[model samples]
Target: MKKRLSLALLPVLMPLLHACTTVGPDYHVPAHAAVHAPQANGPLLGTKHPAVSLAPVPDAWWRLYDDPKLDKLVRESLTANTDLRVAAANLRRAIAMYHEVEADNLPQASVSAATARTQISGESFLMKEKIPVFSIGDVGFSVSYLVDFFGKLERADEAALASAEASQAALDMARVGVVAETVRAYVQGCAATHEYEVAERQLALQERGVDIARKMVAAGRGQPVDALRAQAQAETLRASLPHFKAEQEKAAYRLAVMLGKPPAALPAAEAECHEEPRLRQAIPVGDGAALLKRRPDVRQAERELASATAKIGVATADLYPSVSIGASAGLTGLLSDLGTGQTAHWALGPMLTWNLPTNGVRPRIHRMEAGADAALANFDGVVHKALQETQSALSAYTKELERNLALRAARDNASEAARQNRLLYQAGRAPYLSSLDADRTLAGSDAAVAASDSEVAIDQINLFLALGGGWQNSPDVTK
Candidate 1:
């Protein structure tokens, strides 16, 4: 009986033996992976300075400032920011979906039991008038396995895994955004504070000009119009104080939100940061090749393309036949004969299913192909956009550096001229009008220098953002 049973199972196992053939084209990496490669020489169009450095950007690029306060704020934002939390949840969901798809490769089994009572009428037979009642009971176990003759299940798993990776890349991108914005808000607040200080200094200088103008009038060496003109200038400078304070408050509020706190929760030290932090050295900007590798948006696009390629295989596999094997064994009998072996039964077989061409197979294949093409196009677009943004940021940063240098020189010249005018007026050589004009010129130059200083810091942060830093703090998110 054992030998007969083994022979009977041979046909059921035959389909599984030949199930290794995969039907569709396998995915391959594209030949031109990046749209634009870093040129041998720098592509920066501004001043001919060495293009920063060819070194790879550090993960925590902001730490180059050496500000412990900035480092602490960035760390806090990573842990508490609501947007980053949402991205983490999305990554977990994608990983779960991949596991769900993987479970299809295993065999399925189930058990069943039932009991019923029925009545049969004897009147259905000739010359009979009575009815009889009987009880039936049965229990069984069954198993089923799908033979993956065309690799449909494997391709599905491949697609799911790629999607999970794409989700991880998206989380990295969110980290980059939050870190850059937090730094930007902090820098702006400091810049505003510096501007306000510059304004106050200018007001004191104008008040001294007013005093000189009055002294000239009392000594009968000048007209009253000169003193009135000096008074008007001092009033004008005073009017601008409220505008500068509002700018500083706006930046403070934005920084508070970036740290995931109420506007009133800003730290006292940060609110009083009246001096701007300056970078001591040139920024490090790696080549375009490194940029393509480090940017999260580019990675996400490439993974999406891989997922779409795998889905084509899954859809095309449907054009072929599916094979399955199933087996069942059980016992059934009247209550009186429950212990008898004569009630035993078993069966095993293989099943084949196929769709005729009249069914809509061709249209489904077309749909999958179209989706794959769209994904490929999207990947190319992302690469181009990344290169464009990087180049634009480099040019802008370099130009801002050049402009700041020029402003510094002008400020030095204006300060010297103001000193000379004050000395000459005290010696009775220059008129009070000449000293007042020199002081006004010096005040304007000071404000311009402060504004330019702030812009340099802002442009530097923008360049780092284009290079994609800040994801280093949460290294596991990329994995």
Candidate 2:
């Protein structure tokens, strides 16, 4: 009895052992050559913010600027932006697709029933015309399975899972891009306001020359050309007035919309310096591994690579012959003369499906491999671009910092030069031409300083984008 039991179990266990063979290929992370990776270079600039202690990559990093209005606006944008909504929708779709793929693990069964009636003419195959109409119905359960004998189904599931992960990461990238844009637009608007004020002051100075020329002409001490030149200068400044006002208003409206508010409802600015935001500085460059992990687009690329790898297995499974056993058991009713009979029918045997993979399947397998290769390259590209951006941003920020200092010095020098030249002219030693030259120099220098301030702020925004830090910080939506 023991021998017979062992003999009976041997055949059953034999197939089960071989069933472990996974089709196509099991994935391994592809090796990549790291290029121009950041050494996380930076010096701690000044005292760290009180809110930030050991640099844990704070949530809402933009809010660290300590501006309540800005904080509110960013939060509003996060909730209202249509582009963000689209990204989120895509994420949900990916999740559904993954779920659909996962459902393949279980048997799928459905039920059906049918009834039909038909009439045949005598001319229609004469012998068949004698048959009467009939009603046919079937009620049964059948489950067809590929058996996952080689983990083929599971590999497909893995591919779907990777796709879902990629979608989620894409949403992160979108989040980073939009908030950076919002912050930038707001800063530009504020800077434009400053430029407009400068134009106004210059226009006032030009008006003074117009008045002086009128008096000099009445006393016969100045030419008409002098008054004409003064008028032209004043008009030039006036012409610029509309442009700056338009730009500032545009920025303000954009900001209001981003904050999920009506464009007409922005609060008045108290002080220009107070409106000029200085983001939390001493930007910490975290670990390379962590940086890679934090980047959504990079992760999405890697996930696509994984999905492609699994496809290689799915394709390879086609190369081998598939053997399946099938059986059908049902009831049939027949009526002959006055008799009715019910019978059972069934068939059982190994069914073999065979075809050479090299024929129709080889091209597909090659395609899958090619796709995987492309995905790997894309992954590498994203990593390289990310690193490059951070490096470039750091260099840019450093330069802008230096540029701001130089512009400040230039502004001071030009301002003092104009004041001194005017004083000397009042003391009757400097000519009117010298005073005019000094005024023009000071005005241009002030404009340059204002422009440089905007550049510095813009560079700071770029750094945030390069680092892909918005997601880490839970950035507010861009309305």
Which model scores highest in TM-score?
1
Model 2 poorest 10 in a row by lDDT: 43-52
| lDDT (0 to 1) per candidate | 0.81, 0.68
Query: How well does each candidate superpose onto the true structure, as a TM-score?
Result: 0.85, 0.82
> Candidate 2's error at 282, in angstroms?
2.9
**Can you give the lDDT of residue 452 in candidate 1?**
89
Quote the RMSD, in angstroms, for model 2: 5.7
Compared with the true structure, what per-residue lDDT tens digits does model 2 show for residues 1-479? 54465456557646755766887767766544342334422322221323112354444667756777666666667777666888888888988988998887765554444334555565677574466665443433344444566676778898899888888788888777777877877777777877888778877876886687667657676567766766776787789889988888788777766655677766756112223587665655454565666667877888888899998887777776654433444434332211223444433333446688658788988999999988888877888787778667767777777777898898899889988976775565766567667777877887788778788778877866776767754643322
Those runs of model 2 whose alpha carbons end farther than 4 Å from true positions after fitting are 1-19, 35-57, 119-129, 209-227, 252-274, 322-352, 473-479
* Residue 179, model 1: Cα distance from true site in angstroms: 1.3
TM-score of 2: 0.82
lDDT of 2: 0.68
- Model 1, 219-310: lDDT tens per residue? 88777998998898899888878888998999889888888889898876765678777776678887767777788998899899889989
Displacement of residue 26 (Cα, Å) in model 2 is 3.0
Q: In candidate 1, which residue ranges exceed 4 Å CA deviation?
A: 1-19, 33-51, 110-141, 218-222, 328-347, 424-433, 473-479
